[model samples]
Target: MFTDKLREGSTGPVAKFLFIIIMVSFAIAGVGSYLTPKMDFNPVKVNGNSITNGELEQQFRLEKNKLERQLGKAFREQAKDPAFNASLRKQTLERMITDQVVSDHIFNSGVVISDDLVKNRIREMPEFQVNGKFSDAQFRKVLSLAGYPSPLVFSEALKGDISKEIYLKTAFDSGFALPDDVAVMAQILSQERTFSKIDIAIDAYKKNQTAGEDEIKAYYDSHSKDFLLPEKVKVSYIYITAGDFVNDVKYTDEDLKKFFDLHAELYTIPEKRTVSHILITGEDAEDKIAKVAEELKGGASFEDLAKKYSEDSSSKDKGGKLPAFAQGVMDSSFEKAAFALEKTGDVSEPVSTQFGWHLIRLDGIEPGHGADFNQVKDDVIEQYTKVQSRELFMDKKQIIADTSFENPDSLDAAALAANAAREEGGQVSKSVQIKTSDFIANGDEKAAFPLNQPEVQKVMFQSELRESPVNSDVVELGDNAIVVVHVEGYQEPAPKPLSEVHDQVRDAVLTAKAENASGATLKSVTDSLAKSESLEKYVKDGLIVISGPATISRIKTGDVDAQVASNVFAMPTPEPGNITYKSFAGNNGSSYVLVLSKVVDPKLGADSARDSFLNNQIYNFRYGEDNQIVINSARAESKVEYNENREYLKMQEEQNN
Candidate 1:
């Protein structure tokens, strides 16, 4: 899809930026001084450029976040494993080292991006824009949120990415698909197969099969470890959440008024202005703007002139009408010009912004308003409760954490300390209480809230905590919810007696026997088919059912078993008027003897659109392969040094141990 867009000349600055995002580790484009070798620990050095421990950690966090989002709930279990985190860190470090090597190569290659291109790309980025135009305030606000000290820092980072993008684009262009490649892809995608299946149900094979006492005993003895119960723990804990204090928060009308007065600006709505413009950009913009101004001066309808000549594609079709916007949402110059208009239908002199020159006209305005005390009393009470509860929650959480650690044997002191903190904050005291949990076994998904939380489960089952029995360090269930647990009772894993597991062991042995019987039957059928014999006798005995012949294509493999369909297309084509047989074990304890009777190769069509699509598909695949090769080659040739004792990396190892 991306290759097609690129070929069609539709890929622009935004696409390029998305394609090669800034490599955060080596983004010091103009800030070379920050890259000077320091006494600080380095995790890896690529071609004399050191990747600091801090940079490695930052990149690791970003990569981890991306993975968590991509994997969603499935990543939660993996995140609890320290080993997975260590592996992620190693991968992150390797990527950063590769980026550093690429950054060095780009710098040494003398690639220079023109100033105008950089400025234009920056202005085009949606993150730095408001109302479809560049906004200095939004740009700086995003930079600050992203932890960049200033615009220069973020711009330098962006410039580095842009430079690397040049090299990547060249690499991508090196790949091309020939006519033969397109033909092959089209054939593979459009080929069809017709096959029949001999279905052998495992249960049918197992009808006369049975496991004896000896077989059950043997299986039980061999897999005793699998029969053991998981270790279990019952814990008493005291937890605090922001919501816990919400009801206890008492406030008077005077207090609400005080809060309302303190945050008066937040309650005031900013004035809104509806405006339109004729934007003249690109070659001879000044001349175009002057022409627009002259036409407007000659009593030309502003809307008509805007529809005729405005270069802002987003608004031109609507007579250059922009959505009503308040302060800080438009280019500073544009906002000033529109707001300075004295009345509706007033036109302003031509105004200039980073985008272009524009003639502005005000269409309508909505004056700002502030709510009186009584008008928003309910809102004030809710906001005040939220603020007070959050403060009290944090205070109680701190007291609980400290008290719990000091008195590690019980949650009583911790609970009392939390209550005291609430009392001190003028909240209802003794609302916080210690709660006991039912015995929670390892990997127990049914455990109730707090216990069901993996963080809490991890602490509850700790060897030290279970044996020594201490109040656990505060475990945060979420941003504002935390719990401190003390082991009240514990049980170690133990094997179930053979007598108690006799039925389970017998079932396991019977399953194994059934699987063997099913395999033997499939083998017998395959051997019979190989000898040009038929399964008429077995079919009569009801041991096998032959499914009707069905046709399948790569794009339309209708109603066929997924496993059967996958293997059907991959099987070698038989000679004309010959049958081929392949056997497979089904996921549900069944077996299949696939009878492939025909293979249809796609005939090449004269469809130009489909040919282009196939060509682009192959081109994209080749481009990705070549891009990876370039990166791999750079990595293999780059001189990289690893700091085995970097303190940041050591922490992961220590945690896993």
Candidate 2:
């Protein structure tokens, strides 16, 4: 659902990385070398395959551009925040890893997704619909508009998603509960009650005394387990990207002319028209269009006619000033009629289309023109170079992969093969146990040892890594570099020293002690109020009684606190001077004392308020509990490995701070 609005090329790190690797491989084998590593191009290795920095940078730019459009003025400001950028990087990496995991699962399970299913899913999407039905033209047009490279690629993506959904459904089906259980929960939760209540303030105890040093230290000693620190990593990185070279590039006048001559079609502007309309509805729409056209022919006001008859609220009020558009941008019939008008102030006779009929007027026209050679030369050159770079990078990466796989033992052999295959100025570098974030920041990681990305953590901690001479998987870091890491060393997490968390332990102990002291006093005060018949007596004893015996149901009380409300609703009617009830403070530190005054049983009621309360309680309890149960069950069944690089998480936190 979140990916719905995104264009095909606008992907998170992992998808981009995968795409780049595949494309680069294809390009390398097909075309000669033009890619240069010095030109802000880097590669992340996964298993034996490489995802180029160039590809990732391109995808990142596309995504960034999309975000900029959405964010408008704040784009530059938001982009400058290091923490925000890090978060975006993390999110991209996580998505990529999750996708890889899902894809792996799909392959392992042998879940088949047919081409028809992908087609059906695409057809069902509203973007591909015309007149509430699937249209091939609309499908192709929408895909093109969404930047989908090809129908085959889009279909494959859909199939992957469908396969994942199917896998989830299969895995989770047994977790769903029966209707009877849900209904019984609904009935039980519907029961209501009338009650009296009072508040037991924790601030009442502030006057007691300040805690002593000895007490604080003792508390700290007892709560050291709660203060244990998570493992952390310190990382340094350098980033290389295509945009870095954009300003450095220059195109001479001669180069521009040559480029323009070679790619003249790219600069040729299509004929464009500005059209306005007075649309009318009803079965007699054509007759209305004809009448309006006749009236306009006789010098009747277009503005008045549009305001009177046009159903298009957006343009009709403005005398039908439609936005300027090029040919192939509008409905076929409408486009044809609008473009046919050669002169300004020309009006067509009635034109019929799907939405009804329109009396069209061509307000202006822009005759097509070829772009000046100097004006677009730089852009043309950039495009040509990018294409060349893509081909070169792909071929070089594949050679590395092939050589690495064939050798199957030495990274030196692989590196040698990569170097041999690379074009002029292209080079390969390696780092082990390095974080993906670091790789993204710095184009090379040779100075570092042991790549420590979250994706690598899985392999690093795996038992297989100990037995095998080499282990590798493609890791998609943020900005589209697919890294294939070879696990060199494995480190398991161990408990941190007590000295490392002395201050943290002290703070935890102090908070716990404060809560216990305040909570005990609050509980005593509430217990006294619940047991006493005279709420005024409790008020006299330094507690506040909130009087007005309102009929608050368990549902309303449940919203306050489910655990506390449960205890309150279970209480017997209060007796004079008797006190023994549980009390606790809410999240906002507001303590409540509930005294049972009356109980109402289930019955057929015309009372909408009562019915509504019951319905809410039933839905909340059953649905909430059932959803939790399903989630727990799914989590239990799945083999999830956290393997989070705490060092990376720490680095992110440090940057944020």
Candidate 3:
């Protein structure tokens, strides 16, 4: 809102003194050294601050890597989908923008993370530590590998994450729903609907009628478009894999070392604590805990006390041994006590938690650190060689696709250039309609080769066949594999001849006529009931009356289908004299006449695990809503200019979930 400029080179002492103070103030705030890397493209700008394409690309890479790791080969299919990729890219961009907005808010609000805290946080990070202690050399090497130029850049980013976490923690912990909130959720979860339903068996109606040959033929003629065949393609293709190039690609020892140095962070593990406790419960729990605490003070073994007094059977037999885990797994009071111990065998005073009173001990601590280069050189070399091959493969993938696209006749030229082998692949539809295994004879396995799967079956069907067979765009199979196909033959889609589909047409016609006849009866019966009273008289004539869940909550459906529950909940509460009635289809080939019977209020008497769990869920939900509100409101209020060229991205993101 403000900008300062000296009045035409004024040489006054006051102007010089004011300039000095401004410099000193910025130095004190530690903002003088904070530098954001320069980027040339701005896709999103908020309040005059540009969020560059480079920054968004980095976030996109991180998100893609995470998806690939989790989903494996399935992610390749999703990545190739235009809708999925567009949505993912937009989400990644928006999330990064939100983070930037929050970071800027933190800075403007003067919520500073001290230099000392940043130092401690960096020291504590497992990635940059060596043998549980901070290593400057290790830190530098790891950061450089991750593309951080210096400590200042990494530290500033880390500080932002920490500051945002602190603020969110405060917000999350402060949220508490009113007593009515629990009652509302309980009513939704536990509400019961007394419903009267009637199943119309299609078979009963079909028994009196049979579909004639002429009728089946007429039905087939009308729905001919539904049976249209998918286009098929025949091609000869060569497959190139990283494994095929692994032995051929040469790398020096120095190159292996360089690869290892850059990716050092991958080797580190987080600090873990293995602690055990003797849990005490029931009326004499405190007395038992006190006794155990006393025994520990007298140098009595924790294992012996645990075995004698522990009520937890899972660990008591093994002297209260618990598997190692990082913090956040245990109950809060227990974790606080356990993590407080400085060394192995350091025991804690008996701590009381939701589980029980307990005597705790720190069995061991494994300090996290990156391994030195010598310890993992061979494995690193093998992995790095694969990485190089994948890189080489990616570069050749486009060349193969383009060369085949231009040539259109055969894979011979592309195969020779890409060092791939040419093999014949069959023409098949987009699905498992044609099985490769079916083509193989039991005794002639050596002569049968499995058909190559196209990159995207949908795209293959979508692309038109040229007079001269054209090359397909490269289809990537996960990270290391890719293939391009050239059409050798094309098959046009046509309706199936009636003789082969006669049985299917007969079944379809029977089902259609039966459902239509039964549906008319159902509609007439259900409609008349609204005009008359006493549904019980019709109960003996095969009407099914089922009671809905007792009390419905958002998370649980007691007896009714979730869709039924949701529809009913959305309705206005009925007056005492007039009960609400809704008619709908049931899961079975049936119709339903539902009445909202009652709603139950939740009764959470005294504090218990159930209460804790419910409150935690409520808190998290509200916290998320609160976060969305604040961030969205802030974003809405800010003047954001989006590049028109990239607005297609926003359109795709609007398809969220």
Candidate 4:
């Protein structure tokens, strides 16, 4: 559920806007804002604001960790490539630059976020909340764990983020899609283009693309790093789950009462009303409703009068009866009248609403009530047991953490210490057991229980743990589970021998050769087409096939090659009696030469759903584009400089080759 919420928070305009602000806050704060002092190298300066190397390194690590958690094994593979690492570093620095510029712009624009708002925002985050309410202890604990020396520094960083959020919200909210704008966008998006494609399959070039033994061997020797086995680890762990202490908990009647008193709202059910209404709409509804109310006051059976006079088709036949409903679920006026009744069978006076007039009768009332301790004793005990069990779990968790840290080499001491503490507390629970796992590779999706979790994987694969096989710090799997893992076996990545990977190297060499041939073929074809050579000759000679002259829209391209269709639609339409030609390589080892023949703009008919979706898409795109333009303009206008000699930014000599 938390993962889903985080995913949701990473999407849409406001979420994305807040995400950027938060990332900026992280870049500025660098986790331990209070502890960070002056640094020697300032990696970059935005609007004369220096971004120190220390801050950049921290931000880089944060981004790298987030990416690893998100991309999992894919990121591990990419990390092997020096180019990928270089690009990531550059991208991280660029993000910091963008953030600094945007922050400066927002503050200079006179946007203000109050201290109260910042405090409230912090309070609202789930990380600092306990039982749906903000906890000061939790807040301090989380911040301390996150390496913030104090709340003041984090608050300062948060204020800046909140200010940016307010500025972005105003900017985004100021723009909206007009009907005319939406119509024009719809016509353009739904516009059709007629184009022809010449597809040169790679097989034609691959026929003569063979690599000699020496060439294959040379490639294998040079690119040995690319064909390495992933690093693997086997771990032994001791997990403490909440259930381990639940059976050890003992609760009395007094304890249950205390728990019930503290959480009475949890057991309290909302008041509900089973109501019936005679709705009189149309002309003279007021007089008609009054007459019905008068008849009800005259002691006529309310149901009979409703059946005879009510005009609500859905309820009139059923004696104007409605399902039981609670407050906030009915029309305001209707709910007001229905809930005001003191007892069942009470009839309300005529009430006016947008639906005209309603004369309501309360059929029954289920008044909201808080359960007494005796009434919900079992429930109270269950909750009490859970609370005590969690408290006990925390106690044991602390012991495990201390003992594991002290031992550093094994979990045997941690388990014994926890169970010993449990027995000292007069608990009769089973001793915690040490569980061993099969060899798990870095970011292995198939890793079994406990190890399957990303947080565990992260700690298990930490370089320090691999370098010196030791007990890791306690990792919380969720609210109920905590674990301490120790590396029992570790394997470093090594290149595959030529004897084992010869076929793979030969395939790579052939693929490279085929790619080169495809590039050459594309250049020759493009040159020929540019020189006004007839495409009919290539088709007649069976060198390429002409796929389509079919008219296709952006969303409705059918059977046309994806790359060909994409290029065709993206290309500008030619003037009358002229054609535009574009050449590009296909992802499927083929080359494409596209001819855009004609364009047509066709307006869409009235479709509320499609129109709404398109309007939102257009609005989001334009607003996001506007925000980006603002950042770009600011960056361009700002005095931005980078440290040329920064070690992290430079590619290693080996990678340079």
Question: What is the per-residue lDDT of model 1 for residues 527-594, given as tens digits with 9 covering 90 to 100?
Answer: 99889798898888777889979999888888887878998877778889888989876787666888
On residues 261-370, what C-alpha lDDT tens digit does candidate 3 reach at each position?
77766655556788888999854688989988988788888899889989999999989989997544577667767767877887788788867788888888876567
What are the per-residue Cα lDDT tens digits for candidate 4 across 560-579? 76766778877987888778
TM-score of each candidate structure, all chains considered together: 0.64, 0.42, 0.64, 0.57
> For candidate 1, what is the TM-score?
0.64
Best by lDDT: 1
Q: How well does candidate 4 score on lDDT at residue 570?
A: 79
Candidate 4: stretches off by over 4 Å: 1-179, 194-200, 243-254, 271-367, 371-386, 421-425, 452-458, 461-469, 527-568, 576-579, 584-595, 603-657
Residue 657's lDDT within candidate 3 is 15
lDDT (tens digit, per residue) of candidate 2 on 1-657 = 666645654677777888788788868765333353223122233222333434434344545666765676797567654445557654554444345455555666678888888878886664554433667865775555445556875686678778866766665443333555545555556666665556654444443435566765676566545544433222222222223233333456666567568767667675567888998876567787887888888888998889887999999998987998775467767776776676788888788875668888889877667887667766787776554444444443455456545654545555555445234654333321123322121112333432444443433344553457552433323321333444444334344455675555555555555556666655565555555544465467554556545555645663445665666667764444343344445666556666565666575335433443444555556555544554454344445443234543433332221
lDDT comparison, 3 vs 4, better candidate: 4
Cα lDDT, model 2, residue 534 = 49
Q: Residue 247 deviation, candidate 4, in Å?
A: 4.1
Error of 1 at 241 (Å): 4.3
Sequence-dependent TM-score of model 2? 0.42
Q: Each candidate: what lDDT? A: 0.77, 0.56, 0.64, 0.76
Summing lDDT over every window of 10 consecutive residues in candidate 1, give the lowest-scoring window. Answer: 648-657
